[model samples]
Target: MLETYRGTYFHPRTQFITIDKTGKVIESDNILFPLKKGDEISSINPFFEGLASYFDSKEDNDIKFTCVHLESKKKQQHTCDIEFKTFANGQPSLVIIHDFSDHYEYYQEVAQSRNESVINSQILELQNKYLKEKEDFKNTFIANFSHELRNPLTGVTAFCSVLQKTDMSLEQQDYVEVIKSSGDHLKNMIGDILEMSKIEVGKLTIDEELFDFHKLIEMLAFTYTVKAKQKNIEFEVDFDDKIPKYIEGDKTRIKQVFENLLENAFKFTTTGKVTFTIKENQRRARKVNLNISVKDTGIGIPSEKLDIIFNSFTQLDVTQKYSGTGLGLSIVKGLVELMDGKITVESEENVGSIFKMNINFKYPINQENTSLENKLDIEYKNSLSKEKYNILLAEDSELAQMAVLKILSQEGHFYLDIISNGEDVIESVIHNEYDLILMDIRMPGTHGDELTKMIRSLPVQNCKTIPILALTANLYDDDKKRYKKMGMNDIIEKPFDETTLLSKIYKHLK
Candidate 1:
C-alpha cells in the first residue's frame, strides 16, 4: 500500500509499522518519525510510551492516541493520531499514524472562543453589579442630603412665619417676605432635585385616591391669585364645568403638576399675564379625559430648545436674573407621564409659551352627597378654634422642636409635650392619653416605625389607636406606604407651615 501511494498527498503524512506482541517494532515506515525496523514502539512519543503498557494489560484490540513529533533542526512540531491494532490472536501487530494537526488547530480555536466567552460573561456581570452599587450609593447620598437640607429650611420657613406676624416696619416686613419667599423657593428646588433622584432610581410612584377636582382647582386658584398679585401679573383659571368634580387620581402629584406649570409661567412672564385653563376633551362612561394648559405672556423659550426644555437641569435662560434649579419642567413631565398622561409645549422667544397636558381620571362611583367639602370646612374651622386637646411631639432636632412649639403656640388649643428620644416617647404614650402623636422617623434609641409598632402593641387602647402622624424629612412614596402599613395615620413632611400642620392635626383629631 505504501508503494502504490508513495507520491500522493496522503502518503507522506501517513505511516505504517508492524509491531510484535512485546510492543517492539519489527517492520517500519519512516515517513513520519524516521523509525527503524527494530525500534521500540514507545520510542515514537511520550504519549505512546503509556499506550503500549495500557494495551498490554487491557487485552485491547485497537488503541488510539494523539501524539506529537518534534523536528529539532526546524524547531517545529507535527501532531498525529496513532492507532495500534492486533491480529485475530490478540497480539499487537501493526500501527497506523495520520496527521492530526488540522483537527487539533480547529479544537484549539473552539476552546479559545469558549474561554473568551466565559471571561466576557464574568466581566459583564461584574460591570452590572458595579453599576447597581453606584446607583444605590447615589440614591443614599441624595436622600441624606435632602434630609440635611430640609431640616434647616424647616427652621428658616417656620421662623419666617413667626416673624411675619410680629410687629415690624414696612421695610422690615418686606425684607421678611423676601427671605420667606427665597426660603420657599429653595425648599421647592430641593424637592425637585430629590424628586428627580427618585425618578432616576425608579422609586417614584403614583398613588391614586379619591379627591375633589374642583376643590383642588379652587385651592390652586386662591394660592396663585395671591402669587399673581405679588408678581403684578394677571392670573386666571378657566375651568370646564363639564369636567367631573369628583375624580380618582393621585391628588398631590396632580397638584404638583399644575403648580410647576403655573410656577414656570409666572417666573418668566414679567409684564404680561399667566392663564391656566382646563377643558374636557372626551368622556367615556366613568372615565374623563381633560385637557389642561398653562399659558404665559412672558419671555418664551426658543423653538430650538423646546424639545430639551423638559430635560433635567436644562435651563433656557442663561442670564443670572431668573432663579431656579431647572428641574421643575423635568419633574412636571415625569409626573405627567407617571400618571399615564402626555404634555406638549408651544413657545416663541418673545411672544409667550403655552404648556398643554392631557390626562385621564375616573369619576368616583358614589359622588352624590359626598362629605369632602363639609369635612374640609369643619377641619378648617376646628383648626381655628382653641379646642383643648393633648398632643405629644417626638422630635430629636432642637430647631425643629422649637419651630413646632412656636407654630402650635399660635392656636393655644392643645396641651403639648415634646419628647426628643424614643424611650421617652414610648413612656409618654404608655402613661399619657393623647389626642395625637407626632412621631419623628429618625431619632435616638429606636426609629419611628419600630417605635410606632411597639406603641401599637401596647395594652392601652389609646396607644394603639391614637393618630400617629409621621414627621419626616425624607418622605418618599415608598416611605409613605411603609409608614401607613406600620400604623402611621398620616405623614407631615418637615418645614411644614402653621396652616398645614394645624389642618392635619385637626383633620386627624376629628
Candidate 2:
C-alpha cells in the first residue's frame, strides 16, 4: 500500500522528517523542510518548536495542528499542517509537514459568507415554525371558543323551539319565542365574528350554483315575518314576478346579506312593519341585475355615521341595550363586495331605514335545480308514512335531546335511540343496526370527531359504510371542512329546524 503509484504521493507539497528522542532531526525530505541528518527539527521551521512540545506531552497517537511556518533563512512564510507521531518500541518519532497555504487562503475568503448563509437559514426555519404554531393555536382557539359559547346556546334554542309547540297560552308561547330569538341572535353574533375572521384571513369563498331565488326570499321573509308578527309588527314580502326565480349566484351568501339586513331592521324597531322587497333591474347578455331592498320601520341610522357603520367592529349604538358584536354589517359588506355587489342605505332618524343591494349574476340557462318543497307531492308523502328508519342520536344536553326527539318523533317515520355520551354512542352502534348516526361534537369521555375516526378505523363491517352525521354547535366554517375530511357523512348546525332536519334525514336514507 505504501508503494502504490495510482495517485500523486503526499499531495501538493509534503515533507517527511524524523526526530529522535532528543529532538534532533535524523531523516529529512528537504522538499518543504530543509533540516539535514544531524540538525535539530526546530531549525528548519519556527513552528516545529510548538509541534515538538505537543509531541512531548503525548506518548501515543498522532496529533495534527495548523500554523504559519516562517523559514528564518529565506524570510518566507507558509500555512502548514504539522502531524507529530510518537513511535512504539523506543524508535525515532516522526513529524510530517504539509503546506496548506492555497486551501487556507480560499477558506478564509469564503467562511464569512457561508456562516451568514447558515445563520439566515436557521432564522428562516424558526420563523416558519413559529407561523405554523400560531396558525394551529388560532384554529384550536376558534374551535374551543365556539364550543364553549354555542353548547348552552344550542340547548336553550332547541328547547325553546320544542316548548313553543306545546299546548301553552299565547303569552307563554310568546315568551318561549323570545328565548329562542335571543338564542338565535347570540348564535348569529358568534357566526358574525367567525365569518369576519374568515374574511380577514381571505378564506371566505363564494359558492355559485343554481338555486331558487323565490325559495330564498320566501325562507328569509318567513323567518323575519314570524319575528315581526311575534312583536305585534306587521311584515310583508313582495317578489317581482319579472325576476327570474332561479339564477347562478352564491345563494347562501346572498341569504346572509338579507338576513343581516332584516335582523338589524327588526332589532331597532319596536313597532310598525318591516317590508322585504326583491326585484330585477334588467338583463343584458348572460348577466341579470338584482335589486334587493329591506325597508324597516325602525329607528334609522344617522346619515353622518352611516359611512363608519360598515367598518369592522364599528357601532353607533353606545347605549348598549341591543345585543350585538357589531360585525354583522361588516360581514354583509364583505360578502356583498366579494360577489361584486354594492349596497346603499336610506335613513331618517327615529323614522325608518331602508337598505338596498344591487348585484349582477349569471342568469343560469338551465334551471333544473328548483325548490324540492315546490315539487313534493302530498299524496306520496302520506304513502311513505310506514317507511320508518332507525336512528341513533348521541347528544349530552337534555334540552337539545328532548327538542330533537320531539321534532324527529313528529315526523312519525323514525325510531330514535338517544344516548347522552360518546361511550354509549359507540356501544350502541356496535350492537344495533342503525340506519344513521347523529353525533354531537361535544360530549363527555370522547369528542364526536375522535369517535368518528375511531369507528372508521375499527375492524367492523357496519362501521365501514354507515353514515355518521354531525349535529354540532361547534361548527365554524373550518370545522365543517375538517369534519368532512374526518369522514363525516354530513353536518347540520345545532338548533336545527324540524323541516330541514327531516329533509336531510329523508334524503340521506332514501
Candidate 3:
C-alpha cells in the first residue's frame, strides 16, 4: 500500500510491470501505470490467484487473452499474448504482456464487412422475389380483365349485326355502321392485349393441325381486300404456282398474323395499291418456308424509326391520327417468331413500306409430300342459308344469351334451345335429341371443360355422342387444345361474326 515513488528510477514509456504473489506491483519502470512500488494490482488481473497454478514453470506461451489494462487508475479493454514463469517453490514470478488492440480492431472491421455482404444478398433476393410476383400478377390481371370484358362486347357485336340487317333509312344505317365499327375495333384491341399478356407469361404456343393453305390465303385475301376497297384502294393477292395446297401448321395463328400485317398495310395507305404475295422460300425434308409480303404505296416509314415500329405500344404517328393499339405488329412479330420464322421491312419516308415475313410449315403425316399436284379442288359456298338445324346452347350470361339468340335469329334456319346452366344442358340432352351444343367455359354450376366431360360420360346416347362446341374467350392456344381434349368437337370464340358462327355450325352439322 504505497504511492511513495514518483520518479525514482522509472521510465516514462515502460508498459511491462511486475506484480508479486500478493497481487502488488513491486517493480514498475513506468510509475504512470496507476501503481507505485507497493500499490495493489489485483483490480486489473482478477485471476491472479489462479495464475500461479496455471503457469507453474512455463517460460513461453502462445495462448492469447483479452483482459483489462490500467493506466492512471482508469480501465480500458485490451488483448495480449501472455508469458509466465515460476520460482523454485512453484509460485508465479513473472508475466510478459503483449498488447493486441490493433489486431482486435482489424477483426472487428472484417466482421462488419461480412455483415454488409449478407445484408446486400438478402435485399437482392427479396427484390427478385417481388419482381416475379409482380410479373405473375400482371399476367393474371390482364387475362381476367380481358375475359370479363369479352362477354358484354360479344352481346354488342351480335346485336349490332342483327340491327344492321333490319330495314332502316340511310342515316340510321350510318349510325349503326359507326357502332359496329367501333365495337369491332374495341374487340380487336382486347384480343391483341390478351395475346400480349399470353406472350409475356410464356403461355402462348403453336398448335398445329392439317389445313388447306390455299383456302386460308383466299379467306384472308377476301377479308382484307374488301376492307381495302372500301377506302377506294386497289388490293391484289398472288401466290407462287409451286405452293402446296395441304400443309400442317397453326392455321388460326397464321391467319391472325397475316391479318395483322394486312390491317396495318391498309391503315397506313390512302389511295395506293395494297398487295399480298406468298412464295416459296425454302424446302427441306419436311419443312417449307412461305414468304409473305405486304406492300403498300401510301405514306411510308422513315429510315431511323424502322426498329421502333415493332416495339409494343409504339406508334410512329405523333399526332395520333390512326386508330389502333399499335400492338398488331408486335403480336405479329411474336407469333411469327413462335413459328420459328423471321420478318423484315423496307420503307421510304413518303413512298411506302414492304413488310415481308417468312414462316415455316411442315407436311402432316396424313399427306403424301411426293407431288406438288393440286388434289384439293373444293369450293366454299354459303350452304347454311338453306339448311335447318336444331342447336342447343349452354351459356350462363344473360347478355350472351340474348346475343346468341339474336345471332341465331339472323341465321334464319336454326331451331335453337338455350340452357342457362350445365344441369339443364344435360337434362335437355337426356330427354330430347339435339344437333349441337354450344357450351360456355365459365358458369355458376359448371364450366366448359367439366361440362363437356360430364356430357361425354352420360349414359344417354345423344348426350354421349352429340357434337359439343366450346364457346370461350380464353386467348391462349393451349386452352383450345384443352377444350378439345375434354371432348369438345369444335371451339367458337365469343364475340364472333354471324357468318363465322353459321359456318362453324354447318360444318359440324353436315
Candidate 4:
C-alpha cells in the first residue's frame, strides 16, 4: 500500500487531500476511496461532519463530492471527506479519501414505507367493514319498528269501524268483542315494545321476590286456558309438586315470559291443544332447575325459519296469515335471559311447535308471598283498576279517544273526560280540577310542549301541580326526555294495555 504512493503521494485510507492554489494534490490518503481518474462525485457524504463549512471553504469551493469508506481486516474503517475542485483556469483536479459508509440505509427506508402503507390499507378496510355492519343494524331496527307500530294501528282502525256499526246481531256483537280483544292484544304487544325499549336503553330495573313456583305455573295455566278456549284449543299444565315451593326471582317478569309464549302458542294454534309440562331437579337445599315446555298443535314453523322466529320482527309464513306484531317471542327471549334462563324451541311443519325453557334459581324462606295473594285479590277485584281516581284525557284522534273511553269505562271507577286538543285542554283546566291528565303529545292543532308551558305559566293560585302523563306513539328516549322537561309527570307509551294503563292511572291518580 505504501508503494502505491508516488509524487505528491495519495493513500486511500485517509480521505483528506492537501492541495495548493493550482488545484494539484500535495498529499492525499484514504483506504475506502474507490474512485478512478474520471469518476464524478455528486454531493457531500455521511463522514463530512461540517459539510456546510467544507462546501463553503475556499480550498474545496466549486466542488461536489461524497464520502466513501472501505472495510479492513484489522484496522477500523476510516472516515474522511472527499473533494473535487476546479483550478482558477477551469481545469478539473481531484484528490479522494475514505468517508462514511452509505451501507444500504436508503433501501431500509423504502422497505419501512412499504410496511406502513400496508398497515394503513388494513386500517381503512376495517373501518369500511364496521360502517357496513352499522348500516345493516340500522336496517334491522327499522324493520322491527314498522312491525311493532303496524299491529296497534291496524287494531285502532278496525275496532273503530266495528264500533261505529249500529245494526248488530248477537253474532255481530261477538265479532265486535273479537275486534276489541284483538285491540287489547295489540296494546299488550305495545307494552312489550316499551319493556324491550327499557331493557335496550338500560331503563328497566329488576324487582326480585320469592313465590311458589307451582302457584306461578298454575296461574299461567289458568290465564292461558281462557285464551286457549277462545281459540277453541285445550290448555293443560303438568307439574310435579315435588319441586321447590318458593323461588327467589322476578316472578312477575318470569310469568310474563311464559304467558307471552303460551299466548303465541294459542294465537298460532286454531285446532289442537297447548300443554305446559314442568320438569325440575329437586336438590341442593331447595335449589331448583325447572324446564317448562309448551307444546302446541298449530301452524308450525319451517325448520330453517325456526331459529330466527325469536328474533325481533321475524315471522314465518303461517304467522303472516293472522294478526301479530311478531315481537312476542322476541320479548319472551329477552325476559327469559333477564332471569338468567335459557329458552329453545322445536317444530315440524304443520305438526305444531314446542318451546322448552329452563330456569335455575333459589327459593326464599319464611316470607309471605304476595304474588299469589295479590293475584287472587287482583282476580277478585276490578282486575284492571285497584283504585278510583280522576283523570283528564287529551287526544286528537276520535277513534283512539273512543277506544280509550270504552276501556276506562270497563275499569268502572275512573273520573275521566276526553278533550280533543290542547286548546280545549286549557279551557277544561280553567274550570275543572283532576288528579291526573293523559295528554297526547301529537294533537291536531296544538303541540304538547306548548300546552305544557301554558299550563305551567298560570297564576300560582290558579296553577295545579297535577301529574300530566304523555301518551305518544313515539317511544324514543329523546321524546320521553322532551316531554318530561316540558312538565310531564310521566310518559305512558302509546297503545298501552287495559290493565297497564289502568294500573298507571291508579298509581298516579291516587
lDDT of each: 0.84, 0.78, 0.77, 0.66
Best by TM-score: 1
TM-score of each: 0.78, 0.60, 0.70, 0.58
Q: Model 1, which residues run further than 4 Å from truth?
A: 1-98, 104-118, 214-241, 265-279, 291-307, 316-321, 344-356, 364-374, 377-387
Q: What's the alpha carbon RMSD for model 3?
A: 8.4
Query: 298-348, model 3: which lDDT tens digit per residue?
Result: 789999999988888889998889878888898998889999999999999
Kindly state the number of residue pairs that clash in model 4.
11
Residue-level lDDT of model 2, residues 53-115, one tens digit each, is 644543676878876554635666667887888865566788887887788878877997899
The window of 10 residues in a row where model 4 has the poorest summed lDDT is 36-45
Per-residue lDDT of 1-510 in model 4, one digit per residue for the tens?
556555348423445554443333344453344333322222123343433333324442445544345343355454344555534443334445534444335544787999999999999999999986885566447435744574356346445443645577888778777777666666566666666655555545556776777778777767887777677778888888777677778877888887788878887788978898888754566567887888999988889887798987676764357666677788788878877889999999899999989887776544354345453334434444436667788887665677678777766677778988677888787787766788887677788766877787766443458878877765555666778788887776555545556556655643
Ranking by TM-score: 1, 3, 2, 4
Question: Which stretches of model 4 miss by more than 4 angstroms?
Answer: 1-167, 171-216, 223-235, 242-252, 263-274, 282-288, 296-328, 345-354, 361-363, 367-391, 394-432, 441-465, 474-493, 496-510
lDDT of 3: 0.77
Q: Please report the candidate that would top lDDT against the real structure.
A: 1
Candidate 4 at 274: error in angstroms?
A: 4.5
Local error of candidate 4 at 99, Å?
12
